[model samples]
Target: MRPNKRDELVSKALNVFYRSGFHATGMDTLVKETGISKTSIYKHFRTKDDLIIAVLRLRDENFRSWLFSRMAALSDAPAGQLLAMFTALGEWFGKPEFAGCMFIKASAEFQNRAHPVYQQSTEHKQMLLEHFTGLAKAAGASDPAGLARQLLTLKEGAIVLAAMSVTPDPAGDARYTARMLLQPYLAGG
Candidate 1:
């Protein structure tokens, strides 16, 4: 089914924001790329910030759904699913359209934590941490919170290094680290 005008605008704006940047992609660019007039854009989104929030919401929903579903499909064991998260990320990084993470990009552009965009990024990360924590607990980790923190670090680093390097395999490296860190929990240690 075809998306409504607002949804279509948000989708196009997300791609533009991902390719250029939240701050770099101007209203005029969105108008031109979406083939919708500035008036129409304002009708849907009162301001550019509103549009960005919409784009981020769309990205968050789509990304989480994809990542979690992929992780579930990859492994039946809780611990295996934990490690498979990095595998999923590796495949994502390998995609032709791969750019760094959208939340990371948003954080970089919107440094002020008080800002709505940065807060949205933080919320996205917290959700990831919660997911990791749940997996760690289910896998019988002694310290689920700590394990989640360590894994999140590995994931974030992999994302950054993969985006920065010319021929990156940061995901593989991160998964190896994650495997090592998750070892004790798997062994009932």
Candidate 2:
């Protein structure tokens, strides 16, 4: 089924926000980029923040779906799937449109913890943590929570570095570090 106007607007706005950032992309910019009139956008969203929240939700769904599916496709075992996440990141970083994590950008622009946009950003990361924790448990890590947190740190750090161009291949660097971290849990490290 084709997406409705609201969904279409949100989808277009997501690309705009991803490229230009939350604060940097104004309503006018959104209108121009998304090709959705201000009146129509307001019909679906009460405010810019509301539209931002919707866009973040769409981003979270798309990102997690892509990352998880890529991981699964790369490996059959739970532990291998965990490692394959870095491989997926490598591919994403290579994309011409790559612009780092949108959640990170949103939280940075909306710094107040109580802000809805910030909370939404936090929720996205928490959901990711939950997924990592589940994978760690399934992989039989003695301390699943600990492993998950470490992996999340590595993942976030890799994203930052990749976005900054601080290193030629942060994903490869992350995968190397992840191997060391997961060595104990792997069949033979």
Candidate 3:
């Protein structure tokens, strides 16, 4: 198979995984969706677990790059950048196909703490926290680490509410809450 074929398969698999979920999706389903032979699929990914890891890694890299680019375009003021992050998240959650956070969805599929996917999900959250921490420090927060942690909690809570509730504006509501939380920090800055 061509190199592009491998990429195409992964991309298709990601969409399937995101929509139907990992445990619900099978290799046969992926093969049928991608119009690729099972043999071709195996040639690229030896096992279902391997494919899942690759898809998750791709997701993490894409999210990190997209976030960094968005953050880079904001004001040097960390508070502003932090607010922008929440705004971006709101917009994302409001999308028509937004079923909830990919990592969060995947984490729910596994109850086992030792699962590799669980570790990957945890790493994704940690990366977001680290990014927020850096932004908080740059914005001149008195306690960047604390502010970052708080923002993460706010974001996670919003995601959970959006996923579980019938409200259409979970992301917007969450951003509003985050702004309220950050007001004191911004005033100090």
Candidate 4:
């Protein structure tokens, strides 16, 4: 099926923003990549900043849904679900075209605390934390909040390593480390 115009724009914009920093991406690039006119693009997205916010929102929703679906497919046991989360992240990191975390990238570009994109990135992180916390609780974790925080730290650390030029397999290493750290919790579960 043909993709809708909004999806097309989003897909193109994601690539542009992912390859080039968000600050470097321009409407013209999105227009050329999507084969949509400037008017149509603006009609859907009032401004470049508006489009960026939309893209970030779309990215957050897409990532959350993808992670949740993977977790759901695993056994109802919390241990299994937690392990699956690590595996899923490893798989994403292993993708040939995998770039560093989009939220992290955007946040780095827009360091201002008041920046809308930066705030969206913070919200995205919080959402992930909540998701993990819920999973930890379901798994009968003794300290669900703590476990979630640790997992978030591990994930963010891995993203940083992956972004670095020296760390090959940063994602895989991070997954391994996370699994080791969470092994006790899973065993308790």
lDDT of 1 by residue, 77-115 (tens): 788888999999989998988889999999899999899
* Better candidate number, 2 or 4, judged by lDDT: 2
Report residue 55 deviation for candidate 2 (angstroms).
0.2
Candidate 1's TM-score reads: 0.94
Q: Cα RMSDs of all predictions?
A: 1.9, 1.3, 2.2, 2.3
Tell me which residue pairs clash in candidate 2: none
Worst 10 residues of 2 by lDDT: 180-189
The residue-by-residue lDDT of candidate 4 on 1-189, one tens digit each, is 766888788777877888777878777776777688999888888889888888899889988899778877865677577667766776777777778789999898989999999999999999999988998898778899998898788888877776664577766776687777667766553
In terms of lDDT, the poorest run of 10 residues in model 3 is 180-189
> Candidate 2: global Cα-lDDT?
0.92
TM-score of each: 0.94, 0.96, 0.90, 0.88
Assess candidate 4 and give its TM-score to the true structure.
0.88
Q: What TM-score does candidate 3 get on C-alpha atoms? A: 0.90
> Which parts of model 2 have CA positions greater than 4 angstroms off?
1-3
Candidates 1 and 4, the one with greater TM-score: 1
Q: Of models 1 and 2, which has the larger TM-score?
A: 2
**Model 3 lDDT vs. the true structure?**
0.81
For candidate 3, write residues 58-136 as lDDT tens digits. 8999877887677667645678778777777776677777677889987889757899888899999999999999888
lDDT of 2 by residue, 1-189 (tens): 756999999999999989988888899989988888999999999999899899999999999999999999998777788889999999999999999999898999999999989999989999999998998999999999999999999999999999999999999999999998888777655
